[model samples]
Target: MTEFIPPGTCFLDLPSPFPMKRGGALHGARVAYETWGVLNASRDNAILIVTGLSPDAHAASNAGNREPGWWEPMLGPGKPIDSDRWFVICVNSLGSCKGSTGPASINPQTGHLYRLDFPDLSVEDGADAAAHVVRELGIERLACIIGNSMGGMTALAFLLRHPGLARSHINISGAARALPFSIAIRSLQREAIRLDPNWNHGQYDDERYPESGMRMARKLGVITYRSALEWDGRFGRVRLDSDRAEDDPFGLEFEVESYLEGHARRFVRRYDPNCYLYLSRSMDWFDVGEYCADRAGNPGDTDTRAGLAAIHVEKALAIGVQTDILFPLQQQEEIADGLRAGGAQSEFLPLPSPQGHDAFLVDIARFGPAVAGFLERL
Candidate 1:
């Protein structure tokens, strides 16, 4: 079992309505999150960083006796998320396995891991849980809510679902809806895990986990999370090794294979395949329009511009990387345009980087300042 205790943090046992999206009922659910800095008496300094899929709430700090966090370069005492100037909190998403309610959580009815028994999750529900966390922190309003990828989707959900929750919003490389092409690709990844024999229909015990299936899923995800240009430049179609192979495909067939192997190994070890499947599925089903309704309730509320104008946020920032094909620059532009059309104070910048969708992590020099500059202005 994964240990629940992380150093210097507290777990908040949050309650959820049983059966969530569809199952039956969960007696209770817990959300494991960590906070840095301190909330002033007025509680106006809180900044929430909702993580992307598959990552836990350990956003900054060396908590959980875990390795340096995924975004440590940009979140520290003097970094972009500056613990010194603002109170920062990161929470595991509602459907995540890391001390949050998900497929791995115990099902009160069956008394086993939810697995396939878990109710389906939606992006709006995920965002609602996040809003609950912020409220639990006694933050009536937020300085900003920042998110990336699926986290960005959740951030949008928060704004759409709760019109005035935050004074500012920052969505990086995300869209209002999942593109059909993206859904098609993610479906293949889920299939890779489901087809694995060792998956045992999500009933496999601890000792008999589906490592190979999980690895395949990670390999497939790595392909979509980044750009083809990145792959070509980083790993051209080179030989397996320095020496020629005697018709041997046993070793690294290309630099891309080696790159994928390292990525696959790490992801499989750190993540749960069931969590991967469920979260990816939730992302595929994500659409802001799903929550909005027309007079007939047939689901065609495409004009987010009016909603943006109605929001009472004081300031906001929207950013995108030039090479982020997964959520291309146009999406960020749309968000910025909507905010401006709504008369909200927001700025949009598209950073030029070769790291593609991963630029938010690798292109720190550019992003670091952008983040800092935005927060500083606020």
Candidate 2:
């Protein structure tokens, strides 16, 4: 029912009737973005960042927004991303509720909310919109394009669909395709929202919003975002104080339970339910292997090798956490091997972090250095 647009964000008007990867098109649609540092005289020091499912374009505070951002620690002057040396640009995904055209946005022709009526969204569509933003800024080629989580898939799509767009890449906890387990998890999350009475087939207003469904969906995501090792070491059956305990038998009793409740509450209203369903299914439907030229021959078999080899880049780095379950370490390895097979000197680094899929966000010590080292060499 609400769209969260960060302060000091900039907008780029996409071409009229912007085509979607699946079907349909968007007219007078715009993408939200923010920038740091100055583009060098050569205009070649640009690095574009495509974010995960939920983050806004405000990756780190810029001149217009002084408040801290989601990746504040890793992106700033003298930080791993190092705004001092690079002209950094971060764009929110096209189909996200965060300041981007999505199910939460208005349809120009109908003068009403797009909601489920919005055209089918795909990760490749996000990639295409981001490419349009890049070209609009007069940049011919990017120095590097960084993608995290779902963004990693978008980055790969950007590279393949639009060859020679960037010279390097950094993929953190990203995958070439959605795994069955991940897809199942997202499927359950979507089901939770759909089953909620307040969801009303994506017709609910703020007063009757699907709070319970969103809470459950977010709780499921938080569970998978971190590893069991971290959960055990952090909350390990710790009981809440009697005063903090709930009267209901199934109410929050453990620190982990309280944490999930608080986390879900904070996120429920900030994102649109319909947007969540659209984006979640987008990831499930994404299969980079489908881009391989021999698709007709392969039939149901999916192999990403040929598709990965089709992308061109001078160098690449695929980072993964050993504890990651959603994307897993094998996906990072697959990306690295794929890039290397394409003749880009690529490397895969798997960190032994207990933070799981969210290691890139919290375990900055490892991810930060790896990212900085790769850029330094570039």
Best by lDDT: 2
For model 2, the superposed segments whose C-alpha errors exceed 4 Å read 243-247, 293-301
TM-score for all predictions?
A: 0.90, 0.97
Q: Taking the tens digit of each residue's C-alpha lDDT, what string does model 2 give over 272-369? A: 99999999998998878887744457747777887788788999999999999899999999999999999999999999999999998999989899
Off by over 4 Å in 1: 1-9, 16-25, 62-67, 236-251, 294-296, 300-312
Which residue pairs collide in model 1, if any? 18-25, 18-26, 19-25, 309-342
lDDT of model number 1 = 0.76
Please give the RMSD to the true structure for each candidate, in Å. 2.6, 1.4
Give the Å error, residue 217, model 1. Answer: 1.7
Question: Which pairs of residues have clashing backbones in candidate 2?
Answer: none
What lDDT score is found at residue 140 in candidate 2? Answer: 92
Error of 1 at 304 (Å): 5.5
Count backbone overlaps in model 2. Answer: 0
What number of clashing residue pairs does each candidate have, in the order they appear?
4, 0
Query: What does candidate 1's lDDT look like per residue over 12-119, in tens digits?
Result: 666655335434555677677877778888988888888788767777664444456778798878888888888888888877877777787787777877888777
